[model samples]
Target: MRGDTEWGSIPGLVRYASERYADAEAVVEGRTRITYAELGARVERSTAACMADGVRPGDRVAIWAPNTLDWIVAALGAVSAGAVLVPLNTRFKGAEASDVLRRSGARTLFVTGTFLGTSYVASLRRAMAAGGGLDALRVVVLADDAPADFRTWKDFLAEGEGVGQARVRRRWESVAGEWPSDLVYTSGTTGRPKGAVITHAQTLRAYEVWSDLAGLGTGDRYLIVNPFFHTFGYKAGVIACLTRGATMIPQPVFNVDTVLANLAAERVSVLPGPPTLLQSLLDHPARGAHDLSALRLVVTGAAVVPLRLVERLRDELRVATVLTAYGLSEASGIVTMCRRGDDPAVIAATSGRAIPGTEVRVDAPAPGEPGEVLVRGFNVMRGYWQDAAATAGTLTPDGWLRTGDVGVLDAAGNLRVTDRIKDMFIVGGFNAYPAEIEQLLGLHPDVADVAVVGVPDARLGEVGRAYVVRRAGAPLTGEDLMAWARREMANYKVPRSVEFVAELPRNASGKVVKGGLRGTPATG
Candidate 1:
């Protein structure tokens, strides 16, 4: 069955799990625990609802909500109905979400109401209104009290009442392994996000290998703290759990108290996220109050993994398997991962060898030196959706994806990611591109020029510090610039520190000397 191409579709995998796992618990959120069979039924009902709403194969459906049972159902259901899933970041402001929805041409949007005191639906509406409206977009609110203007989740599912199960099944059967299942937007140096299209086969196959390599299996309780929008949470977290029949506990946000409570209450054994997440768990004042003994496997990467953190996770936390993996959105969220029983030092220093069926190469200037990491495998994305030029730039004609990350492959085949070839930084696990922030900062009336660089931080691993050249006699202060940036961009993209400069250092070709900006003390 693993060798068959037809079984690699999202729906196909769900069906297989349902049939095999039967009454086994599949998803757990709050007090709700759904069996694999029950999940299958819900997915089918949701698929019918999507088809009733005229969703067709290749159509894009956007989901803009935090991690919840409904998020999983909506995503899988949309794919089952033959629509491509486009996950919008929960941190995205109105304009950012609007840009993705507009570019993806998502006909349907599944959004949540008030969360953390902010109404996502209202925010999106404001953005759409200002940005010429999303063409032919239908809003579906997933809330207990949905606004009167849009369809509620219950109402949306109720639309399937008149539709037959056979129709839904037909749509499910029509989808094949090669069909595009997801369009995940990744930020680039170009200052605009590009949607990396991935197929059902690619996702299922890659994560099957990921699940196996990570030692995921039935009855393992998985707590997913990563955002559902990113490939890390959706693919490696959710999809991996599904394929392995692990019970998934979806965490909406990364609150230490909530996570610790869930870890104790649910007996979560499988947890994966960036190093910051694990660090927070280890650093929390009340961490030992909760019974975290159930934690056995942990996967972390995306930023430098401190040797101390790896040692503590093993010695202090007593986790049996602490694996570090690496990849980008273009490669289905996993290219290389450490195996269980690997040396703690090796796991800390390098992202393990490439997963089965994937190849990693470093285009080094000198032997064993750090260079751009290139990947070639079934895991590679189909391409940047509708952007041939960007696709051509990133992917070689033969197949290797030119991952802009700089890394070196050791003699043992382990990949140690060094600096980025592109000016992108990770802020608490979120990718923040300097060019995008610089572009937004350049729009300030008092700003004459600006350059952004990643600076080391105690908490977030790396944060952006902007070096700004103000207009002559301008009264712009760093505080004022940051305040403006907070309003204009996502929280992670906003510069944590700002420094005023007489002039930005530039080279002969007139490029901002980002190297010179780093380590410079923040001004104001």
Candidate 2:
């Protein structure tokens, strides 16, 4: 059955999964294990808490945290109470996250206290500058312990106890499939991130197709190494599991040894993440020490997939199914997917055919030629949140979405994405936009100008390389600038190397010639 038809809304799915798979294990985070029944009860408490905290239908609720059971419960609880979810990237710095929450006018925020040795609450407070920037946000709940002004997870949940389950059920049942589910923010070539508004119906239908294509089943132990903020992890990993009753083991950070330990300990059967993750596992020196016979499904994309990698899984690990897919945040994060029984060569070369109800086309000379990929489907987003100009530019009046990705459509209907028209590249698994990085680099006082380009990396698939022009009389060095970048942005976005140039190459129109910058010599 179509997920939308079966459950109608996410709240409906939560209720059904709770009843049907009550005793089945739902999530495993370290020593913490929770059954489907426990997850449902937790979600219900969260929903009531949201209502108690002034969350209403159509309000925007944001969560800035990693992949954990608390993140799942807090986000779902808000959605069940009819608030549109806005998932912030855990890698984003305080200013980056603050900007989104301010733009979205998020009514409440659920954040982690400290993660990876940094205090997230303090970071956001610093970025907010004495709370002057966030007037809309009424409450801040911490997943760990409450600070001076914020509420703790325990205290937050206790407030909902006064609100009965009957009232919570009414709030959950009031949600319709047509209501907006999430506002997924994605940066474009313009150097600003825009939120893509996706509806409940689109999310449900898309991931249902994802689960069916990936062959997910009940009781399958899934180790989700992908960050929950990305659509790949949240929908394909979380939402897909809800439909199939699979066990979720969310790994907050990507560590090879931790992944191996979880796989062997939990008998993980489904592992879906970027190609780099699988490649790391295949090359890990300690891989043979773990009993990995139980691993059966692997879904990877966001970078090139070598045919040898596919062959190795079957030959060495004995995985039954391995698939690749293509998607973007604007299209509900799915476009095409490789089926279960596809040939290894085809799976490596193409992203398979379009989903059941969508149409794919390319503006090119012929089938083999490359062009801008266009899609029209139920999966396309409503539009960029409150930005009609961007919506008009992205969507045609005839209903086709102008995907900025460059791709070639074969005669067999398979899509092979070749390049990015927006100059976006995937570093490990994260999308790195050159324009965004260049803008950030321009913030340095000693830098006269900057241009960033994607450079080939053996391990990360791609990393940023910046060609910079130093201001006259400035004594800044490449080593000094790179260290500055580490403190400024996410680690993946920091350029691996930098080169000082006298001037940047540009055309008559004055746009930076990135192709020339891509050839600039690195300092190392």
Candidate 3:
């Protein structure tokens, strides 16, 4: 690896993979299988196209598409051209996509027409109509050939000759001006989304450390189901394969039947995802129809995985190489992970240890008790973009990142997460941030004031519930409020129930005493 082996930089590692395993399969989606040599060729072609299209060093190229071969190709291409890559989540609506695109100041965008029943092109058109036109966005490349206003992928790829080897070599040798790579925008749980500036050095370090621990390398097959917009999919899913020359099987869209078939068809050796994704695969009625005998390693984290689901993968699926890791976007996703070949008890009980070269410390511990976690390593982000005050509050001057998570590291160096320090909760293992719910709840016509709290549940661990003060003239019942929430949010994020009250209990500073409502017997 000639490039910076830090967290954010993985281009040099990709170069290494191409050199070492040039003929091996790099990306496989549907009937398309691209070898490392072929993949690198595509990356080079796209990089040339990017440069020809006026993408420059430090420029932002937003990849706004679902998980597809083109998404990975565009990401690597933009990075190779010395442009920053900003991956947009497919879940975002037109307004959300426009906000991210506008904030990122992207010069070029690669979009898709359709994805899993979602009309992506329609959304983009709507975004443009809403005044967030692609003014700075000079080039728009469509992933699939369709009758759209954008150019086709083939035409885009042909813009640059594949003979820019000299230019690429020079740029690789003196890859200055830009910092390997940069990922902006935080998956906001609070107010608005702030860009978290992660340098290439920081990102590469996180991937290298994790790849070593997970024992990934050439000849290994890894199936990636998570979206690349998130850290878990980008670092662990994509970079892990590139750095180690392992085969990467990307799913354009998540389908239980499709995944099950691919796992068997590809003979995938390693599988990693959030608990819900894995559970859906295992619980699928057709899961047993596939031959998954080649599966050896199974890694999962992000949300609290049910013990039963873990045990089922082990007992029923016959996968012995099972491990779980913990991380946050701020830490580049995988600061701590269960070591390979550990005892089943340890694997199930703890989130493993801090990855090698990363420092993990708990601040504000209450006399032998664990408090908030603070991390220092190449994995931590540089800072929150353009928000010095918020950055100062979250990141210490000494470069330690405040994780806002409560966890204890036992004497054996294993970490056990207890709860979050902030007012947030997890529903069905997905983070149901309280601020977002409060914002949505406030939109109710009859809602005067509202506060959201997490209540304990056996199946989901914690489910969100709302307490509200209705407007005097507005006729809003608890049932109506609950129904309204269900219409706006994903099923898991919808509150289980709503309680209408005259007023909510607030402290001297106007902060609601949410703890008081947790175990209250009264509904209102």
Candidate 4:
């Protein structure tokens, strides 16, 4: 768990993990339990499939699916074959998903057949039909039943029969630590989603620090509720488990009942997610029925973490370590974290001090004052994918990353995040950028203008509230707008409440003054 020097690349780590923890359990899904050796063999088969399907080193490969055994294998396999992995948000609607695939120039896609009763292939086809569609994509492998022309998962793996084991090993071995491992697309204040290019070394080193700090060990059973499309789920949940030989039980959704069931059934020992998840579990009336005694470690963040949350877990569930952290995709999804055995007040109030090999500072002149948060460290990403202008704008000449977050750093160097410079909100654990939501809402024919702001919610840390200006004679109601929005974007990105206005307030610079809109009272 040292760093890149210990395991040259992700593939190397996978190989070593497979051998070191070979007999130990790897992934448990329903009745199936895959050992480390078995998981390695599956990843190799998937890597061979990628090779057979013409995926070359540095080629972009996207996966539009949820957290499952297949997702773990497909993603790891693509990276092992030296392909740059691009994971699509499972919550994204067809058009949104297609937009990323088109922009990333992904040559291949591994998608689930149907999830939550939606046919992904059908969804993609409809979205693609409206536009030029994905003409560059040469392969579409479905985890379930195959469509007319698309290949099934079994068939896709079968196609790799011609590829020998030696060739697969060589391809993976050639993947250097410096090579870009994945392009995680994240939306910022600009409303346009950009891919953050992170290397295998950065991911490994950062998560190695994360795993060690959290005391993740070989015998731990982890319940990964975070979406795989997110950095927390893929890197922290999956990658960290690989490093420690922990068993992963991935839950596709955040249903409270399912989580309770898994905690008792799987004897889940490690749970890491946003504050909303832990809150719901704490409040569930049926909590006492389950034997949650096995849970030892709990890591939660991404919103205002209540001091009671840290105390409740320790008092109610008796979890040994409860830590809070803060991160962004630009910094490999980690910048600061509360160490184990830290003062519960410090862990609850701030995201703790910076990890080793990193520095965190605020733009304000004095300590304990709100200012732009900046990070310069080993965890910083190389740059945005193929966007030099954006990269230059974000990264300083001296290598400090301008994290568009307003925070106050204590004299002790603990970072207390105050606000987002981007006006971003977290719906459950998902990040909902207001600008992105506004852009999508602007597409509605009846909407002439829109502004979105994050309002405090009792359950979710915050939810989006949109103020809109309807077109002349449009007769658009908030209900109608919300209905249309539900069809257009991911559920999390859809604003919970909408208000129709004759015109939106604007500053002299002709920008929709969001600060004014943020104070607008609920009209429903």
Give the number of the best model, judged by lDDT.
2
Better of 1 and 3 by TM-score: 1
What is candidate 1's lDDT per residue for 138-166, written digit by digit as tens?
A: 99999867767789999999998888988
Q: What is residue 24's positional error in candidate 1, in angstroms?
A: 1.1
- What C-alpha lDDT does candidate 3 achieve relative to the native structure? 0.75
**After superposition, which runs of candidate 4 have C-alpha atoms over 4 Å from their true positions?**
none
Clashing pairs in 4: none
Q: For residues 324-390, could you state the per-residue lDDT of candidate 2 as single tens digits?
A: 9999999999999999899999899989889988999998888689999999999999999998999
Alpha-carbon local distance difference test for all models: 0.90, 0.91, 0.75, 0.91
TM-score of each predicted structure versus truth: 0.98, 0.98, 0.90, 0.98
Candidate 2 Cα outliers beyond 4 Å, as residue runs: 130-132
TM match of model 2 to true structure? 0.98
Tens-digit lDDT track for model 3 on 1-524? 32253322455656677778899999888889989988877777777778767777778888777677788888888887778777877666666677778877777878777776877777777778768656656545565464456777777877766547777655554444237376656645465666677767667767777787788867898888777877777778888788778888888766778788889999999988767667777778887779998887888776666678778888988987788999887777778988877877777777899887789877754533688888888778777766788888888989899988888877887887777877667664466677777887898888999888888776566788888888998877777778877655545567787777778998999888887777754353
Error of 4 at 442 (Å): 1.0
What TM-score does candidate 1 reach? 0.98
What is the per-residue lDDT of model 4 for residues 4-111, given as tens digits with 9 covering 90 to 100? 888889998899889999999999998989999999999999999999988899999999988999999999999999999999999889889989998899989998
